[model samples]
Target chain A: MSASHPSDQDRNESLPGEAAARRVVLSVDAMGGDRGPATVVAGISRSARKNPDIDFILHGPKDELDRLIARKRGLAGRVTVRDASDVVTMHDKPSQVVRHGKSTSMWSALDAVRDGEAEVCVSCGNTGALMALSMMRLRKLPGVNRPAIAVLWPSRNPQGFNVMLDVGADIRADEKDLLQYALMGASYARNGMNLARPRIGLLNVGTEEHKGRPELKVAHELISEAAEQANFEYVGFVEGGDIPGDRCDVIVTDGFTGNVALKTGEGTASLIGDLLKEAFKYSPLSRFAAVLALTSLRRLQKRIDPRRVNGGVFLGLNGPVVKSHGSADAMGVSAAVKLAYQLAASGFQEKIAARVASAVSLAQDAAERGTETE
Target chain B: MSASHPSDQDRNESLPGEAAARRVVLSVDAMGGDRGPATVVAGISRSARKNPDIDFILHGPKDELDRLIARKRGLAGRVTVRDASDVVTMHDKPSQVVRHGKSTSMWSALDAVRDGEAEVCVSCGNTGALMALSMMRLRKLPGVNRPAIAVLWPSRNPQGFNVMLDVGADIRADEKDLLQYALMGASYARNGMNLARPRIGLLNVGTEEHKGRPELKVAHELISEAAEQANFEYVGFVEGGDIPGDRCDVIVTDGFTGNVALKTGEGTASLIGDLLKEAFKYSPLSRFAAVLALTSLRRLQKRIDPRRVNGGVFLGLNGPVVKSHGSADAMGVSAAVKLAYQLAASGFQEKIAARVASAVSLAQDAAERGTETE
Candidate 1:
């Protein structure tokens, strides 16, 4: 469980949880995780117990969902079950899902978000399939050429996290698309991290202005010029080493590079965690040391746990949708649900749409000015 | 100091240190390191003490170098200091260095290798400047469109390291360039890690053939087809997480992504190391625990220290060049020298040239076959 302040509980108590009170509704795909519906149900129950002004629309097979929800403790008035027959398997291809996934739980979850029944959708399914379904159901926002998936990265910043975009939405983004990602990512940081003006960085091999590919150079100029309109500060270029440091709040890059960097950072953290555990168990003296250092180690582990930050938000869509990790357990799924609730509560979709629109206009104006000069 | 075996010393002694016996000579840029000539001299002393068949051509001002080497007892006869009045400062731009750096220590070091006086050149200067100077001085090997820089990354392999290419050589690599990176990286792994048939993996966001950019798909096919001729096993596409795993020995990628992944991995490891120290110093009980676990922790630290694996080898060049980290200390510099010595002793330059030449021929053949099929 997360460490909650007393003020959060007091605010939750002040808001009524009844349907008539218009509580925020999150659509949940209650199947397709590695651990199945049981974990999803447990995660929803945990969230429902903590947040009083939230409700869920659970999508899955009626019989299986009924059985799972019956075993949970806090689902009497906070859940609405939606019967769906099909499940999107992890092995299903994205193109295949687009053609034959009409009845799948993942599709139905996104449909709820599209139909205005839920503010956001949360799913732990095949990423490609989920992304395809979300794009099909919600469609891209106007002036957005490419949609991006943004995730929160642990950093040394005072806010403890930074936003990185296009983790896996698409493999490539041109200079214009990168500028759009910066604008959208800055908006996400403003809403997610409560910063009025987020510092944005374009990810490259080196921080020097003269370094990196040609597209990055153009993107740097565009993002720098658009920062005032986008309500963000352009930090020029940043390298991968700065991703975990306190230099920038938003890192923008093509999905290919961003996804690789994200996974590489995760893998490195996991390797070190495993090695540390091995070190603590090396001998009797070390085992004794492990016991003495248990509290501090646990605190450190909790601080950097991947399960605590388990969702990648699909930006540039009609409605916000979060893709939870496929192998996530109850804790991970709960983290995703919490992210969905927060985004829905903050109305992040409208903010992102406005930001993208203004940035697109700026880009078009710059293009027209260039043509006139030529 | 490294844990060395008696056989290593025996093999080194048998090779003989005399010029007639063809001792491996390394050209070292002794001016640009943060610690200046003192650290470079100490590093050469360490290498000279360890490998009897190795000699150095140290490039710097002879007056200051003589004073530094005189304090180090083992470096007297093994090092031959070449006086160069000018030094390449870290702040110098690569373009500026290319235009007006004839008298600099870095240029002299690389010139020695180009003139066949040394087998390899090692420098601890600005990376961009060093890379530019190496490419200019050594020239590209036959059929290499864009030369690559291969680095030794700590991994779970039996050799305890993996070879990753194009770390910061060039930002863009097309399908052909990627294939060349694969070939060059495999050669580096064979000579550097002593793996006869090194497994080569193309770095991408996903491992599936259908995933990533169009160029990656073409590269996947090209590298998979050319594996046999390149004398390495192709592991197809690999994700960022695989960089530290045992799935492959060589990871081929463009300079942009490779550099980002390398720095991200370093940053994550540094963060964990810092957190571990914080945990150990939390309280009195933990302080006692730290004392008890000092030996095991020290072993773990030694196992993952970046200094032990210092130096990024510039592949696809006429002669080998290793770039040590700018902030490296004596131990780190010594590690770079040792790597340069091993690579020079193994005749990696000729081997990489041969590998690139053959791979290019196969690519040309494949192109002709494609034209015929069309």
Candidate 2:
């Protein structure tokens, strides 16, 4: 299956050749996560200072947001504040936010992007809420039936990153959704990583044709067909263990299973590292040995930390809604902001739309051709 | 819910006393894997030699099995090869063998324990065939509705092992099956590990009460009720990350998801470790540092290797059907033999049957008593 898009050959000129291509896009949800505006403001402030070429829009209670950014003088000029009275609580019901919190910090942030005031939306809060809000407000890209939440994971290799999608967007997805996810993932790789054909894997129980539940079986068939039409490369089924390996560039699965698997991997990595640390501290000799190997251990720790790739982009939506980790700190939030800026800068939306449209078109063409032959 | 049967006061037999109360008994399936009967025979010969008290009844094609052991004349007399003309072929369908090949090597192995020819049945052949044959031959322990495959995972923690059941028994299971899994897992902990009150957890997406699919919701209610009855200590729901951390002694889940999660964790661990090893070989300096940490790395590898704990006993069956790994070698087959012997020694069959019967009886009793009280 093809992972690269032939259509992409003509589209990359927008980056350097076009003078206005670097225009800063995307609105940041200030009142999100444990610390809310304080951390969000700091993260955006850091990104803005690092890269003066980007613009930002912070959405939250005007007075509260302004108060948090009061000390950071120039951030207000670089990024505008959109007045929003309400903040969606961390534990707020996903459906409740979509139905009742239209004027909420999260909704307002996404709305700005939907209205073309910004190109992407960043939030460290409810992922389900962002998914619902984005699809409802901005609408799904043409020909894309379902949206997905894609996150960049720190790969086992030092120089690489693994993109895993449908993190928690849809619980029970059809084959069409899986195909859409692959297209979006491949688009991200080509546009962001410049890979000609990104290796894409279906996150499954095993590599066999009949390994997983029925959804995977159907997804495999559709993905293979989609790849045959040159939408994006479709690699075979990949085990959950292969996520951090160099085996696949993009891995896709239904949200529920993906969420559990991702979290488990995170938890296990941290738990093991911590256990080893404690074990090394048990005796003076081991402690001395740990000190000697501290540099190597730190490098290993840096390779697996979740904080390295903090944002999970809600792909296939009309606009980007990068969901920052719930327990994200200042550095994690900053990393997320930078990722949001890249998603906006990389022309991810346009690339995804083109490839997804082609995939859908191919499906329709197959059906039309079948009828004609009949 | 209660994970084990009979209260702590009733089953507090000391380790020494319990050790004296048991005798190692194993039934060997003399064929399977790449090496077939040769590996099985070698493993049996090695284990019996290592543990003089361990006894074995080798059930298979007697003439061929005898030739495999013909070179080891000293140990040949210690092993008794029972002739079974019909042998379960790896290529044969699992259901077909159980339905027609009742005199096959696998069936005869399970039959040895089922009809009291031996205490435990060990098979390196097809698991489905053994599971099916064991059911038809050994009567189900009363009140035990469905059998589950249980494996003890040695975690990074030195405290104790974690018992995970239903790796691939029932594809989809309801609350009662989960409840039975909890009971069976708890029995292993209390009896095997000598834990006074082993902690029990349901494998889930999250810790929230309302979290999880429909099956988990119902199972949660039943598990809580059983826990309140003091059957086995229920430690509440735990996530996938908790497996390697030893957060709970027993974890219960549906077979399909459980199997995926188990393999995923194992794969990820190996993948990460291998990546680290390769990275360490990048430079001469890094390789030197790795040499210094070789002991620690080897210790970690030994702790996480899947092959080290390859055998999983089919719990809730009337008799034993120990399923060795499909990739089993001589060492793995030897491990399976040891596990089968231990299961018989622990009297798991009778213990689990009584536990299942009592729970059903109590539930029915409460239902009838409520009618009178109301």
Candidate 3:
């Protein structure tokens, strides 16, 4: 693999000066996904064709990646293959990965962003391992105690999606960390969803002020106070139903709860979809009905398809990192690549960093006021 | 309303001796729901028509409830309307209800159970207020610390539903409480779902042992230790997806997470259904397809309809209490009534009490062993 390592300098020299200067480079891990490297190469190819200004630094076995990328004309001069001898398995522990995963493709992909060679990193590897490597390489942003992973959920909102944070970064978040999530989530909504002043809601069991855990109550006060300074409207408290509702653009919660909610929502949608298929196949009349309703069914499928929103962005980090679904197909991978490109193009990293910095000071001011009140 | 109170002695005398001896009475609160008392009366009527050995003690403004119950011939000899001067509104706080709600229908309904006049109590009132009144009237079962609310979730299991506890009883639960919930939930599954040996899974962010909050890990060990003695299989930790998956028959968690997961699942299913309707209405062809596929669509709807399983049972209390959906229609309320009748018929209260008692001793033994080990 080391002998087959391709020269990035040669690839850079081959690119036109104007195109190379205008393109935003993305770091992609080609191995460790449930589907293998072919899907990753296909994804970058789709992105390359769709956005001429997007380029990729794909990390994997150099010989394999070079052959895969060579098959796509659009990705010819747009992708740079980096050699990584080892790959992280899905079963690898995060702690073990941090200690012994230097030669893995996931590590190499994050290193591209840490070295300032790419604007963003994307991978469909083990989430725990990837987050571990991302924190080790890219580090956390200033004033961010615990980083969060923000994902887009299909919603009835005008933007067609709501941003939910801490979908499995760390399982626990205190009042201050939740406040930071609110600020960072608002920044994400603004840059990713194009909401000017996103409405932020804290996820809880009920919308009542006096409900939920004690930490959530303190977080409610902190998030409510920071909303005005953070430039996002605070929507008091929202329940789980409000996640896909039009009540708010950003929902903030601890990682454990958010992860469970995300998976539950996905599981339910998947179950309904499966039942729908079984319904359509129940009888010959229904099978004929299915043919007539093919377009409508496909339309519904596309509207709620998990593949359409394939990336969970790792937030509050030095550089942006998007984790694609582990079993993502070519199209799902493409969606993740497209999200990464958009985030990179919007310069979301700098904006989120600034928002988090101001939020830290706002938290300090609130603490001082609490002391005075006591 | 006081003048219109129906005489229970007259109704009881009208029934045949054999029928009265076998009838299991359910107390129903006919106020505080979003739709009001007409739906509640209609629900009990639906249940009464289905089960020959069921009777009801309907609590509400006697004038209104009597008028509603008289229209259903099935409920003519089975219902004894109790006079309740006031109704518990949705806006009433639990604290206020506990202190000043003696005259409310919700309070009167629970009193029937506490007084041993009814086998189970069913309410469609404000959940917080209902839980508070139930606690005040019926008290906790022996060896139970925190009472939990358990609900059935539509799942891929052979039983078609999984029991999840602490959906909204209280926000916090410790290791002992979770262990008790596991025991109580297992008993509910045995009697309610007819599972001889139910498999219980502790809900967590990940199935891995080292994930989630500190309390979950401790609960995991305690529940595992108590499973064999309690006659249920402990399947370790399960994620939110498994709530609707076939991996386990019971999901145990704190009230906060379970409530959120339940609501999130419902919300996601609802959003998809709405999107599906919009898909079928996209064009004239899709409209024609909708007409042709009505039967298939209805079958699918019946399978995933939340109304089909519309009750949340409050566990760990001296008497079983079923909380119908606040916005439930007549059909939804009827499903809840049916569940309450079945639970009463199975003597779920006594079984759960025995399980909780044994679990208490099991927990104490584990604690003593831990002290010795330390």
Candidate 4:
């Protein structure tokens, strides 16, 4: 909250709002998720009714969204549809959508955020496309090398879960990019987790020097040196298990590995659930046991619902962008809509951008000075 | 069973009664698991009693094993320990331990298997050290270029789980290693799952050839070519989610990525379990509901237990080498021991080695011949 605002903050303030109490959070690319706009409409409609303080504008195919809205008249209360023909499907290549399919829902949604029509833009389109679009349209914060997607995985430890960045954004990375990811992740944890100055960990196989591939080893050095100069806590190294445990709070990894771990976590959770059900089917007696355990199972299901954590915040962009989960249903979409509004009103984007820019500049200056000494 | 054996098998089998059904499966570092040798003892004792067809030589600290076994009279039966003070803890650097600690339980264990005192060797110690010892003592299969670890992950399809290979063995992998992993994984599924010529899928980010990193693209080409000349079916590329949902019977990946995925899966499952308990704790009514649902919950827990899965079999070695889960308890260690025995009795080592040798030779010859055309 003490951080200085960007140049555009003044512009945004006059055009729309600041960290205000209540406002509308417009959503773009409503038809971007697994179930398309219907689910998006359902989520936002529900969210709108639940949060009377907020309003909604769904951007997508007018006809499809309208017909879907007609089916749920009660949900149409605080929601309105802004028709855009483009709908990004799961099968569409990310580049194709970004470079060529600009007319799609994602772009329209991003435009809403850009023009101040929407306080926040949210979509579950291709992660790469979303990153590219948000960065290209909204622009990157000063001193940031690139934007990143941050996901909070459920931790097994008593301490809360850690935030992992660049899940599927930068495939080819360097030590510099990794440093930025750490700073961005830390800034996110600070705002998202409400930490004063969060701890950041570089995800690695081992803690020793030269432990990972040449690039990662160097990245570790850079992050450690940068963290020393920055205001946040820098934990030396974290293993795979540490991300989901109390071992660390902010995990930094390349997009390639991060994406693999994130998706692997998702798939594994699903497998465990399915496998547990099958185990109960081993015999009639076990089946009866499964019935008895239904209440615990339901609670567990809610705790790790794929839908609950559907939105991934695209950090380091100029404005707020919430990337919806790939398989988000109505509830997931609705929650994401509320999440975007909260993020916008919470001043998350401005706060993170200010902190990251300041920290990164300091790191760069320190690195330059170190080189000069050498 | 029909294939030719690798060089290690040939060297080991030269000893007296080495090929006999009652051969001993020597575990060098049996005391390394979290639960110590109790699990190993149970596994070895259980197999000896059930089959009346095998013996187990525990090449570890005899006094320590005795001290523990003294507390459990019934399980101490059918297992023998060779008093060896040397140990290789999980944290020991692999090369350092192998070079300086050759007399360690790990090395001694592998030595037993190598010198023909045991038919196979299983260890729960430092995995890297075990791999080094296996390779150093037994040597790589004549034509086999690399060794890999294969474990079956529970999938969603009614058909059950799928086998994924090379989960953290080699670091910088080439296409040939992936192809070999695929072949080895298929063999395991055929024997372990009783599936005839199971389907094989490359654990890739996408179905397209250019989807993954440079290495994967090259690996995909080689795998497709290898599949054409192999005995099993090659299904094609698969994403992460495919592993849990049984998209294919065999999934292949380089060890680095595989290891992260496996651990993430394990963490996710545990995280869900914790979250469920937390959710239930939210209310007194929910607590009662959790109790009522305990039956189904237990079934789920039983289905996804890492202990049930036990260990990952290190393929491409001269003999059957099972690496128990790093965090294995007494029960899991015991299970891995039984698996090692089963691998020996089923002649899995001989078959794998032979197949690997022939396949490697064939692949090499083809490469040499094919390069002429290119």
Candidate 5:
């Protein structure tokens, strides 16, 4: 799809200089979500209304998107549609997509970010495919052996969230890759959480120095040495239970372990939540108690609501990209959009690139120094 | 520690024939816990009162344990003290313990099970030290590469808990090791949950067959082929979210992932619970609502209490040895003791040994068959 439309140029020319200067354009894939294009359009409309400075390059079939966008009063002015005839289904393999997914909306959305037309891209498509496409289009940052997906987990910190990395970018990470994750995650925390220096912890089975695999021990040493250079405090090794605690702001782990921990945490919270509702509805007495406790329960629910933190940012990429949950509704999608907007506005991608470069050099220097000492 | 006490012989001789036949002696390590010998003694007393047929060989300094046991009304009759002066501090490394922990109560406790004086062993010591002692004393069952620590996680299953293996055993598991874990976990489920045939799932980041590391793919094939011979249904691959769901009765994963997920699940639950309490105590209205919801809240609290399920059973060893939390109180210790008693009474150790032996043979057969086909 071409971007040099006469109407688009006219609309941009009509905008006041200050308003146009402040605009942050986000590329959004309107296809591939389980809820379909209508939800995506509505989610974008919700974000556009809330944040006047945000603009969207909506990628999907033009006819359908135009009809959907017309239903929302103020969304038409902020949204620009790019027609992509094909959709990436959840069943499509990442490898297959890379080989032949040119016409898909997911690819087009990522292409917008790659072409510098959008500051960030957001998609509720298949995570594997999205990661694959993003990596192929945006490419990994220099010295980034393995790009990571950093997620915001509900935590006891004053910020109410903690950044966890390598959520599912790749299944394997060597000691050095873990070190990179620590650095990238810390940068994300610093930029996203507005922390001067975030506390980073390496996720292990135990906090003891000698406890866990040999690689973890090596990673511990590497991360410890790199902490000063990376500008984040290393909290040593932390247990999985520390993920949601105030012990660390950035929790780094291999994607395999981090992904499992992430899903396990979500599953557990959901299980307890469902059980609590069941308890409240058990009998007439509990039903009355539930009514009395409704406000407190609502407050608690708002505190732990998964939708409030719905995005998993693809770190170590050339441009910022967010993978919203496949089943995310309008609010969840809006949350992801907001996170993307925040990252794009703050130029987080550039910050992460600089941080990774320095961290890698420091780690190499430390390794060489160790060899010489030995 | 001598087992040939005149009073023990006298008690055995004095018991009625049926009562003596039904008795199951549990070897107890009465040291290394955060609460010390008093809590262990109280825990043993609690278990002894609840089960008339249960007996204990308590290991600790005789002078200290004897006085502690004397204070309990009915404990002296059921508990026989085996003096072990040395204690394995939590700070002690596993390798050091294996080399020089012979004089520790943790070693003596496992030795009791090794000598057939007790059907099972229960200890609230450093997990690494306890596992080391158990492995060194009891030894691994035939054809077992790595021993796994199987834990009971709260689940939505009919049993209210699911068995997850390698919770904090070794941090690594290959395809063969995973197959062994599957068999051992299934056997534990059969005995612990009393299921005729349990559904076993290989834990992964995703349920897709083509996803995850290479070893997991191999494990999926191996476990699938060995399921019928191993007397359990292989439910293919499962994700972290499945740990607390009804999709599987046993979740098998490498210790690194399992331990992290376990701790993360606990941490997330705790974070949410704490937040709920804070929400309830925010104002007078919430405080009044909390009072009204006290019974329901207590029910929920009791439902998820870690103390109720307080044992991590060491599997793939010659006999069952339970590792209770080091910081356990009387209630937690009693819960571990109860699990030990149940497993010992049901001959769980022998059952697991036989199951592992057969499962190992079946796996070997499957591998050979595949080689012949190739």
Candidate 6:
């Protein structure tokens, strides 16, 4: 596989300066986005212009990516194009991809992180396939039964975003899995949003102590007990409404509920946006009002735009991977790249690993104590 | 208990004319709402003004309700004030409410529907307590394992609202329950939205056939098999985004997921509204634009207002019960009363009962056929 991509080695060896080696290298899958590799190159170019201390291990067909990269002056010596024959499509099944996705650009991109060449991998591809390839190449951290995908949600918080997890990693999460999600989500908030001691809220139907499924009750107790050891505040139970409110900085739930809540929020925001447009276009006066209010409306749009928070970081993996939206444009991809760079700079992967490792031991000790008391 | 509330019988017999007996009588609980009986009475008065063929059996303390109803000239001959000594507070546990809530307005409200004195019941109370009391008083229909709470969501459909069920009835729903929810939801759509044959969608994490929990797959097959016999179109799996879209008329899921999605959507919509307001207030130019766009903005607001679609109907019971928002104002209460009247006029209770029975038999037949094949 390495022999097939000779251009990767050549590009790396032909770096312009020794100082360039110190730049944060992000593994990027260029072929899997809906807008194709040109948008991806443009996104990386945007990031290169903003951040002087970053490089990209661009994975795709070498000739096509090289051509795209050559057009961007800012990305000249900042990219190392890797050759891969296949592109994992949006419709590809995760199971099939894991079995036969070796030659795909997504797989090649993950290998750059797996081989210690890049601190992070970012892909605008099928989320399930990206998660699968990431798990296969990077593997789960020790003591992690399930790796979660955490995303940033626009919220009423002063930081302007709330962290929510496992937004479609797997459907089911038991008490232990939820506890792990809380740990990982809190770490993400601390690093991603700069929360000193992020407040953790367990997502449920109601805020009552005795509501929701049996697992949630157990998870509630587990999360509460671990909050002290984990160095985060535990706000017992939170409903879906609290996800966007300032009630808590991190919301933890099973992937099923979290995913549905994420999509429902997105769908509703999109609907409201569409209705707003229709309202402006309803009458001549309103249309003119839209013009006068353009600056304010644009400011509102910039505040809540989903593209501003484009990356969904896969947590509990050996190496961090950011799954950008498949339909992301250049700005969206640049947002993801910026997030990946931040996480890499903050040593988020190592911090969360330490958090989960401590949590596992804490759980084991609590279980042994429960057995002794019984 | 009925003997103690003598005012109920006296007011019932004090009707204006025999023609009033032909009107739709809604059993409305006046005390349990966040706003007192005044808001509830104002709500019924608004409804009475708009709808000539509707009357109410207003349940609460006799003296308080009589004063409130006497003030509303529109509600003079239309309201029958029932005396109930207790009020079910929002903080009351559902189990506690069921055991000791016999004297509450919410309980008395359901009794009017249970005893055939009213066609439907409407209450602005604790949803958990309302559902518990509804089940206790009206009981589940035959072959109905779990009763579901269905609400009207603003959608892209021409009808402007799509039905989503099991919003917070119970945390768990097996395949059979989900199938029954489909049946009940379809019936609600047909009667509530006046759709000839409603399209039903099963809510899941993903739209893929192989995705989601094991029970959802089983529900997918069961719902598919029953669609033709149940007189609805099965759209297979739908994700959360489709809940507000026009992809289907009915979205069915277990109570946990449905409740979370509902709250998440409401929260997101509210957040956007707040952000929009903040945007307009940011600058003097934008404030002027807001004044000019007031009518258009008002139009948009009315179209998506949650108050307009206020009722959450408890289905799969012998009688229908509308659970309005506890914080609903007079206009919100009027919207709920309107929904309750529409449901009663459409013979929605009997229609859903018949639909569920036919689905039970259809499921039985499918099971037998499956056994034969096996």
> Chain A only: TM-score of every candidate?
0.93, 0.88, 0.93, 0.87, 0.93, 0.93
Ranking by lDDT: 6, 5, 3, 1, 2, 4
Where is model 2 chain A poorest over a 10-residue stretch in terms of lDDT? A1-10
lDDT for position B200 in model 4: 91
Question: Which residue pairs show backbone clashes in model 2?
Answer: A2-A232, A2-A233, A3-A233, A4-A197, B1-B223, B1-B227, B2-B227, B2-B232, B3-B232
Q: What is candidate 2's TM-score for chain A?
A: 0.88
User: Backbone collision count in every prediction?
Assistant: 0, 9, 0, 19, 0, 0
Which candidate, 2 or 4, would have the higher TM-score against the true structure?
4
State the number of backbone clashes in model 3.
0
lDDT of each candidate versus the true structure: 0.84, 0.71, 0.85, 0.70, 0.86, 0.87
**Model 3 chain A — which ten-residue stretch has the worst lDDT?**
A1-10
lDDT of 6 by residue, B1-374 (tens): 00011112223343422323345788899988999889999999998888777778999999988988888888787888889989999999999999999999999999998888888899999999999999999999998999999998888888888899999999899888998999999888878777889999999988888888877887888888888888999999999999999999999999999999999999999999999899999988989988887887898889899898899999999999999999999999998988887787677888888888867878767645544543
Q: For model 1, how does the per-residue alpha-carbon lDDT over B53-108 read when each residue is reduced to its tens digit?
A: 67788999999998998999887777888899888888899999999999999999
Superior by DockQ: candidate 2 or candidate 3? 3
Docking class of 1: medium
**Per-residue alpha-carbon lDDT of model 5 for A98-154, expressed as tens digits?**
999999999999999888888899999999999999999999999888899999998
Candidate 6: C-alpha RMSD to true structure equals 6.0
lDDT tens per residue, model 1, A1-374: 13121225223432222323235788999988898999999999998887766788999999999988988888976788899999999999999999999999999999988988888899999998999888899999999888999998878787777889999899989888898898889888877667789999999987777787877887888888888888899999999998887789899999989998998898888877777788888888888877877887886787788788889999888988899999999989989988887776666777888878766778877645533543
**Higher-DockQ candidate among 4 and 5?**
5
Give the candidate number with the greatest DockQ: 6
Fnat score for model 5: 0.85
What is chain B's TM-score across the candidates, in the order shown? 0.94, 0.86, 0.93, 0.87, 0.93, 0.93
Once fitted onto the true fold, the runs of candidate 3 whose alpha carbons sit more than 4 angstroms away are A1-21, A370-374, B1-21, B370-374
4 or 5, greater by TM-score: 5
Residue pairs with clashing backbones, model 1: none
Q: Which candidate tops TM-score?
A: 1
Ten-residue region with minimum lDDT total, candidate 5 chain B: B1-10
